[model samples]
Target: MSSWEIHAIKYADRNARVRGDSFVFDDNHDAPHPMDYFMWLLRRGEEVILVDTGYDDAEAAARARPIRLDPVVALAPLGVRPDQITKVIVTHLHYDHAGGLRLFPNATLHMQAAEMAYATGPCMCHDTLRMPFTADHVCEAVTRLFSGQVVFHDGDGQVAEGVTVHRIGGHSRGLQAVRVRTESGWMVLASDAAHFYENLFARKPFPIVVDVQDMLDGFDRLLGLASRPELIIPGHDPLVCKLFAPGVADHIRRLDPGPTGKVPR
Candidate 1:
């Protein structure tokens, strides 16, 4: 099996949030619950595959999100450049995940077929449904499709020798999760499938969801995909940084090693 080095790079964070903002059924609805935004980098020898490209400055300004670093800056310490990136596995089309689609000009994007359809299809017509996406980002994906730089997957797809993507729609119409093979074990990147460990452990769904049941099912799917529960990484959990040790830089956490200790209660 091909072992890949995976780094979770936190680019932005939102601290002005509450439990209600994160979970659909939290008893402490008014309590604070911060969210950290991240873009994962997967490396093997000289090859690199980026998981998601976080939104750029315009998005941050418009949305009132204080994104700390540009995707390029966040990745520079690890010796990864946007131009050198050859492949990108877009977990979904939500603004945070796919807003920077044009960043990696040379890379072929891997995505779920249903994602594009959902983004472009009638589902986006609703105001609430469309708020999470930026029109320009979706247009950029369309541009990639026209140029044959976008690779569409129906359900499960392989991005590389030991890295695979599985459709685990719920948050978005075609949300997917990336499963990677590491020396320690199989690490499943549960992007938005579980925003926090609570979402997975408590069997609860995140608030910004399209299909509640699919999100619930995806939790089990994430656990099953990994060699163990500790190998399952949540998408926007601040607890991730606390649970996993820093790598290369403080914000860059090495996920391939799995967690350093048990999740704090």
Candidate 2:
């Protein structure tokens, strides 16, 4: 298997109160459940794959989610130019995940067929289900679809030599996660499938769920796909920023532990 360098670029975060039952399904605690937003960058040799194009300032202002930096701009520190990105794997069409699609003009978008149908389907006619999606974000995807920029998948498939995308619809109808073969092992990017480490480790589902059963099953799928528990990274967990590559000034983390036993010095 080919190994690649993976980096999670955190753009925004929020500290808010969350009800345990809503998030955990059974637990009853109501306390602060901090969440972070990020977009991942994967590089191997000359190929670059971006996972989830995070939302912009307008969406943040509308949703009242705090914004620190634009995800596209955040890539500057990693020496990645927007035009150089060839493939962008959208985990789902949630505004926070797919809003920045326009930034990468040259990339081919990868999305699950079920997810696109869900976003544009009659299910979104309901307010509760449509709240997480932004009209413009979904519309932009439609525009891309018409332009032949989208590569839609019915289920699971390899994204590249070492990267693969798997469908695990729960958080969203078309929700998917990316798994990359790295020096450490297979690191599964459990975007929204497991919002935080607690959600996965405790089998606690996050509040924003489409199908409880799908969400629960996705946890098992993630475990089976990953090489190890530690290698499976959560989508919005603040702990990820700290644990992966804490001391670095920039958020970029070299996931592959090369010959030195550590990728980053």
Residue 202 alpha-carbon offset, candidate 1, angstroms: 0.1
List, residue by residue over 1-265, the lDDT tens digit for candidate 1: 6799999999999999999998887899999999999999999998899999999898888888869998888999998878999899999998999878888999899999999999999988899889899999899989999999999999998989999999999999889999999988999999999999999999878888889999898888998999988888999999899888899987799988778989643
Positional deviation of residue 203's Cα in model 1 after best superposition, in angstroms = 0.7
**Best TM-score among the predictions, by candidate number:** 1
TM-score of 2: 0.92
Model 2 — which ten-residue stretch has the worst lDDT? 256-265
- Model 2, global lDDT: 0.83
Q: List the residue pairs that clash in candidate 2.
A: 115-174
TM-score of every model versus the real structure: 0.98, 0.92
Candidate 2 C-alpha lDDT tens digits along 1-265: 5689887888887777565623765555776677888898898878889999898898888989867888777888887888998899999998899988888878889999999999999999999999989988888888988888999988798889988999999889899999999988888999999988778878888878889899999999999999877788889877776676532336555555522222111
